[model samples]
Target: MKPAAILEAALYVDDLAEAERFYGQVLGLDLLAKAEGRHVFFRCGDTVLLLFDPKATEVPPEAGARLPVPPHGAHGPGHLCFSAGAAEIELWKKHLEDHNVAIEADFEWPRGGRSIYFRDPSGNSLEFAEPRIWSFT
Candidate 1:
């Protein structure tokens, strides 16, 4: 079977409201749905981004209990990446820079195109990569 692409990524944050403000207002993700104090969902192209409160207690038993967030400076692999064309990448770079978002780096691959790295208010590493990264066989 072919590998299925990721449909969504759930980030456990200290506050869902803050996540909504950052991802929705700051980063400008299209808000698709939300449940107060529990979670918020955004539409990233065809994929979904789910933000949840780390302290929320409404999860089903089968979903397990919520856990505390890791202390600062402890590294983790949780991140969300967006794919864009070269022009779209530039547009996002300008938009982010104009909004005073700190850019971690902007790098180009040997193949073609480039990427920009940044973080959300919750410190989740977000990457916007050029779609051409996958164009080559």
Candidate 2:
């Protein structure tokens, strides 16, 4: 057997607060958890989006730390897409524009779904697309 599903996805940023506001306020994801200067977490449907500070995450966990997650991070922008339907894609376009977030791209996928792309404050590429872009129901 193989892995069942993705439970979490992570993106790295230099500023935790800015990332927090962008994902929490602009994108309107509910606050799940946060550790000042280290990371911020948000709930998106059944999965968790983890935004971490590169500086903090690159430093290995302290001795005796409750969770000894090893050092992990990325330098440049990463991408994450939210599942949205054709109609919801239109609503998201307006919602993001209302929040002053520019839409970098908007188009229909060749296979038969629509997608709109943008960026977060930390410059990570973001997208809202129909799950059917990958043929998901």
Candidate 3:
């Protein structure tokens, strides 16, 4: 059976508080949860963004109690692209700039859409593109 859609995406960060501030305050994503020094979760539309601490999540927990889903941590920077309406693209760029986030690059895709790329506090590459960028509709 084919999967419906992505439920969550994970990114490893060295600083959870900084991630929380950047995502929740700067990016305006809803803060779903934060597990102290372990991880921080944010709601990105229907999907969830999970930021975990590599050092905390990479090591398997001691015997006895264990997480239902074992931690799967990643290292280095990651990338996540979000869909935006054509008219909202400019607004998004302005919003990002207003928040002091630099636009790494902005491009008009040959296929017929535009995208803006930027980095999160942890250096994960984040992108926002017109829905048609991937021929979504």
Candidate 4:
């Protein structure tokens, strides 16, 4: 059977506090939970955005640990794109600019819709695009 929808998305960050400020303060995602020097979780409408400290997650949990989630992480910059409507994308562009976040790329897709790309403090590529870019209704 095919999986349903994505419930959460994760991104690796070196600084949890900085990440918290960016996602919570700048992007306006509601804070869900956070562990200092570890990870920060945010609510993004129907899904959750998980910002993790790679240094902490790359190592396996000690034997007999309370939560024995397997070690998982990524190195260097990763990418995450948020789905938005045409109007919302425009508003987001302005909001990001007001926050002094540089927009690295902005353009319309050859087929349709628009997308803007930017980087978080940790250098992960973040994008906002009309879902129509992929022909999603």
RMSD list, candidates in order: 5.2, 1.4, 1.5, 1.2
Weakest ten-residue segment in model 3 by summed lDDT: 62-71
Report how far residue 35 has shifted in candidate 1, in Å: 2.2
Instruction: Write candidate 4's Cα lDDT for 51-99 as tens digits.
Output: 9999999889999999999999998999999989989999999999999
Report the lDDT tens digits of candidate 3 across residue range 50-88.
999998887776767656457578888999998898778
lDDT, candidate 2, 3-59, per-residue tens? 999999999987888888888888889999999989999999999999998898889
**Which of 1 and 4 is ahead in lDDT?**
4
State, as a TM-score between 0 and 1, how close model 3 is to the true structure.
0.93
Sort every candidate by TM-score, greatest first: 4, 2, 3, 1
Residue pairs with colliding backbones in model 1 are none
lDDT of each: 0.77, 0.92, 0.90, 0.94
- Clashes found in each candidate (C-alpha, N, C closer than 3 A): 0, 0, 0, 0
TM-score of each predicted structure versus truth: 0.77, 0.95, 0.93, 0.95
Question: Residue-wise lDDT of candidate 1 within 1-137, one digit each (tens)?
Answer: 98588887777666678889888987789999987987799998778998876555443334443644333222343677788877888899999888788899999988887989998777878899988876857
Question: Which candidate's lDDT is highest?
Answer: 4
Residue 94 local lDDT, model 4: 96
- State how far residue 118 of model 2 sits from its true place (Å): 0.2
TM-score of 2: 0.95
| Candidate 4, superposed: residue stretches over 4 Å from native | none
